[model samples]
Target: MTQYTQKVNETTLKMPVALLQVGMFVCRLDRPWLGTPFLMQGFLIDNRETLQSVRALCSHVFVDPNKSLIQLRSPRERRRSRRETPEPPTLSPTVDRDMARLGLREVLPTYTRTLKGVKQALREVGRGHPLNPERLAGQVDECINALIDNIPAMTWLSRVKSHDDYTYEHAMHVSLLCMVFGIHCGWPRHEVRQAGLAGLLFDLGKLRIPKALLGKPTPLAETEWQLFREHPKWTRYLLEKSGFEQDVVMACYYHHERPDGRGYPVRKLGTQVPLAARLIHILDAFDAMISYRPYAQQRTVYEAIRVLYHGRNSQFDAALVDQFIELMGVYPMGTLVELSSGEVAVVIGQNHDARLLPKVAIIRDRNKNPVAEHVVNLKQLRDAEGKARFRVKSMLLDGSYGVYMQEYTRHLVLDASPA
Candidate 1:
């Protein structure tokens, strides 16, 4: 409504953050796009929160006058000139209920296809075939779509399944987490696709490294370590040659670099590392910690979460780490947990508001015997006193009390009905 005039000769105009309005289009910021929470290359200022977010991160931004809904005019004249834009429709309760009832089997096909595509691409890279950018992009897009359809189902499957080969499994895991993180942060679709691609390609260079060195049980000597560190550089070269975009290349190349500048390769400090790279770094580390690598012992979900929480700001971006923890919940999916009632359960979904309370599938009864699987929404259940009916007494290891995720994952596949 504030009347302001600026030269319209240029396509982009740099204006102070104070002049930014809700309807403006922010084409570029004063700082790098990846350094801030705004992951999209460009975005429309849709609401007051978005406007404030931009203002908080930047002093000035490059705006495109053509993209904005309003032009220079007095408040009264502007109100009369422009038609009010309708707000986007919110999901109706019926739609929400349907999505809630959507079976995990409904999403598994897409998830499997995406994972298979990732494995095939990584295998091609291992065999010295030239990377296909178009194919990789398509794979990433499918992955993004699957996550959009049902994030909890995809996430649960990703955590439950593991490949015989670590390289292939790790690539898919990191890529899935990257896509999930992007969506959780409310990034635009383009940025989410880019993040997914970066995750898939981030560790392709490891294929070029010798298997002996990678699978070595003991600590690597300095020479081996130095050679191991060249994976990022190799990734950059491979992507550059494959004609991938510079942003994706940079993300894969610098994922090992850390916020505190203590990370490997170039040792980029703080925002010097791109947001996608910083995001991939967290996922890569978390996956690695919980995974069964030859050199390291597999850690429980709670242990991995602790490592990420403690390393915040020093080894990783503090805010991103917090968000990652929040996304995964205190008891992440696929985790084996013992409830207060002496039953064992596997975490299936997160309750965002209640970090400790999560939706789970009870697999074992109080006597540690196998039982019929039933989902318990911990957030919904309450005792007469209104306290949580069944609290997670303790986190269990992968194969606790004769119950294993691998077995229940099979059960889930066969009985694919909605819980």
Candidate 2:
């Protein structure tokens, strides 16, 4: 029999790769961490793909039992667990039935309407007209209400829609993400709406920047960069002059501020920054990275999430970054992914507690050809052999294998009407 090392007296235990589970915390790899694709030095095996990767990478690893979500068990129990196939976590019946009641089709109109409001607000700022607070408040209220009723539908719309005009589109995306995150944090409805408004108006200052500078594909000169940093101040000035609430104005002003004091326009660090400002900061950075910008190419959702994780406690608020990751989950809405069965699908709904088992809309078959759209709930799916039927193999970029979210909007019952 092969000798297996299990140091019960130490904080870290040596475990064979075959004994690893989804909730296990892998603290050290047998090989150099840099050689592998993991973003964090130590992380939990949150999903099947990560578990498989670790099995393929090393024969054994060091796991921190205290950091793991699962309990350390006897070798007999561990062997039994390895022999039984693990199933995705299941959601409560009431919650499952409630989620099924709402769909993207029911929420698309509200999303489109809120997007128009975002565009109109930018137009007001550009024309030097005062932003109509009443109009803005109405739109924000409607959007928040829609999100409160159905988070997945709103998130799907935000991820799928990308306008040629990046300004308002980016604003809309940030605002929706902020509201969703606020709800996840259990904030009151009024507070969630405030965060959404602040995010929607965070970048009005950029409208005051020069068009040449905004569109410049090359690096900005020092003088130009200095001028660009002044936009946050301009944003504050514009919002205050329009008689907006002080909280909204301040959030917009400090949205660029970083926890490490490296951010522009005042460099407020730590607890000195308001909670709303900190929340907007993470969402703003994330949407910008994933959006098509003048100087930067669009990144995949997973790529952007990795950047956020690496930047925690430095570029963004640490707790808020963790909360955002939990809110978005491993496969966020609208993520294009390839299944182990070779078909391609888009994540459409989250199973709440079961973050790894999101409901996906299958759009392409094994041959990578377009097919009639169908929804698959990964949590409940099982094959004739009673094993898990589908598992996500890997997440793909926006246009991988000719799968683009924009091209499938019609099938999603969105972008079919004039915006």
State which candidate has the highest lDDT. Answer: 2
Give per-residue CA lDDT, model 2, range 163-239, as digits (tens). Answer: 48678788888989888988888999888888888989998898999999998999999999999999999999898
- Residue-level lDDT of model 1, residues 1-419, one tens digit each, is 11232333466766667568889888888888777888889999999889888867876787887898767344344456555754333213334324433546677677677778877877777777878899889878887888897787777766754436577777778888998989999999989999999988898788778999999999999999999999999999988988999999999999998888989798889998999999999999988887777689888888988999999989989999999988887887778999999999887767654668887777799998988667777866765544567799989866679766666666666654645
What's the TM-score of each model vs. the native? 0.73, 0.73
Candidate 2 C-alpha error for residue 40, in Å: 36
Once superposed on the true structure, which residue ranges of model 2 sit more than 4 Å away at CA?
1-102, 352-354, 381-389, 414-419
User: Distance (Å) between predicted and true CA of 314, model 2?
Assistant: 0.8
What is the alpha-carbon lDDT for the whole of candidate 2?
Answer: 0.81
